[model samples]
Structures are given as C-alpha cells and as structure tokens.
Target: MPMTEEQLKGILRRFDTNGDGKISRRELRVGLRNLGLRFAGFRARRSLRHADANGDGVISEEEMNELAKYVSKWGISII
Candidate 1:
C-alpha cells in the first residue's frame, strides 16, 4: 500500500538528519542506501533532478509528497 502523508513525513524526518526540513543530496543518498536502493553518483544526481521540482538541489516537503506519489504509482515500497 502507498504511504500516507504522515507516514512519508515521518520517513523524511528520519532522513532530515540536520532537522532542516529538507533532504540534501548527501542525506538522500544515505536515506536511499538505508532503504536498500543504493545509487551511484550519476544515478543519484538523476534521481535528485527528477524529484527536485524547484531546482533548489534539495527535496522539500512538497517535492517529497510528489515523490511519494511517484513511488506509490511505481509500487516502490519504502518499508
């Protein structure tokens, strides 16, 4: 099943190591790795590009929501 917004927020918070309310590239890489979705540098960049809707080089709450939808649509399980 797809994650709820609250569930997604909780997961994102775990990755927000600095508690900055955003996920930086480093954090994203670490988070993905923890989720068993390791990616090389180029692949990581591509993933970030796809999710960074504002082109701010980080994933904000809004972008994360969009990402959650994509993940759900693709049947990607975070658990």
Candidate 2:
C-alpha cells in the first residue's frame, strides 16, 4: 500500500528531534533504533551517509520523505 499522510507524519515526528520539520543523521539513527535496527560508530555514520542527500553527509527532511515511500512500499500492514 502507498504511504498515508498520517503514517508519514508519524514517521517524521519520530525523527524530528528539534521539532524543526527536518531530520538529521542523529535523528535518523534514533528512529532506526526505535524500529529495532541499530548500528554503532562508523557503521552508523556510513548508514546515515548512504541515505543522505546533497552530499552534505546527513539525511535531510527531503530524504526522509523519499525514504518513507520506500518504507511503506515494503512494509506489510493488515487491515
């Protein structure tokens, strides 16, 4: 199923630590940990970079939004 606005908003809320409507690498890792996926040290940095946009070395809100679509496409929901 496609990503619902509410679901996407929830995901953003989970990562938007500063309430600034944007997510940094630290925030993304927090969200990943909440989802039961954890990495450490260099691995964490690499993972975040892999998802980053603009090569600034952090996943921004735009990247997070794009990622939400992928997450919803792969996630299974019963209803």
Candidate 3:
C-alpha cells in the first residue's frame, strides 16, 4: 500500500528531535536510519542539505509538501 499522510506525519514526528514541528538534516538522517535506509553519514547529510530549502538546518512542512507533490507527479512510493 502507498504510504498515507498520517503515516508520514507520524514518521516525521518520531524524528523531529528538536520538536520544532519540522525535521532537520540530523533528524532525517536518524529517521532514515531508523527505517533501515542507511547511507554514509556524510552522504546522507549532504543529500538532505541539498534538499533543504530554507537552509535553516531542518526541513519545514513546505519542503515536505513540495516533495510529496513531486513524488505524486513522477515518483513511486516505496510503501
């Protein structure tokens, strides 16, 4: 089944270490690792840094929305 919005939100919540209602680069790395999607630490951090829009060290809801839009248009959900 495709991942639901609730599931995604839950995942984000679990990883938002700073409790800022947003996931930072560090959070994403830990979250992905928790999900068994391990990558070289530097590589993962770099990838997330590139994806982060505001450069605030974390990803905001706007970023996630954009990602969801992109995936809906051209990518397949792993779940």
Candidate 4:
C-alpha cells in the first residue's frame, strides 16, 4: 500500500525524540534502525545531507517532505 503524505509526515514527526519539532541525525538513525534497515547510520547521514536543504543538520517540518521522499525511496513498509 502506498503511504500518503500525511501518514509519512506523521511517521517523521514521531522520530523527533526531543519533541523540538525537528528530526535530528541521531533520531533519524534510530528510526531507520527500528524499521530494520541495514547501515542505518550511513543512511541517516545521507538523508540529513539530502533532506536538510538549508544545511541546518536537521530535518524541520518545513523540510519534512524531502525526508519523506528520501525514505520512500528506501521502500520502507510503514504499515
């Protein structure tokens, strides 16, 4: 089943451990590992580099869509 944008955003939001309304590198790694992804640390680094357009080193709500797109490419089953 294809994931909707809202669902994707909600999942991304859950990864915000600090609840600061942003997804950090460490949080992203943990989230990916939770999804059973191999090399999650490397993936998180790449995702941060890709999704963090402003180079802030974190994925904010404004940058979430990019994160969603990147994660989707990994074919994650967010069911």
TM-score of each: 0.69, 0.53, 0.61, 0.89
lDDT winner between 1 and 2, please give it.
1
Q: Which 10 consecutive positions of candidate 2 have the poorest summed lDDT?
A: 70-79
Off-target runs (Cα >4 Å) in candidate 1 are 1-5, 40-43, 73-79
lDDT of 2 by residue, 14-53 (tens): 7777777766667766776776653524444664565566
Q: Which has the greatest TM-score?
A: 4
lDDT tens digits, residue span 1-79, model 4: 7778779889778998889998999999999898788999999999999999999899998999898888888885454
lDDT of 3 by residue, 14-63 (tens): 77788887876677667667766647355447645655677777667767
Report the C-alpha displacement of residue 62, candidate 4, in angstroms: 0.4
Query: How far out, in Å, is residue 20 in model 4?
Result: 0.5
- The alpha-carbon deviation from the true structure for residue 32 of candidate 4, after best TM-score superposition, in angstroms, is 0.8
What are the lDDT figures for the candidates, one per model?
Answer: 0.69, 0.59, 0.60, 0.88
Q: Show the colliding residue pairs in model 3.
A: 24-58
Q: At residue 14, what lDDT does model 4 achieve?
A: 94
User: Judged by lDDT relative to the true structure, which candidate is superior, 1 or 4?
Assistant: 4
Ranking the candidates on TM-score from highest down gives 4, 1, 3, 2
Could you give me the TM-score of model 4 versus the true structure?
A: 0.89
RMSD of 2: 4.2
Q: For residues 19-75, write the lDDT of model 1, one tens digit per residue.
A: 898878888777767777645354456667888898999888878876555444434
- In angstroms, the error of model 1 at 6 is 4.0
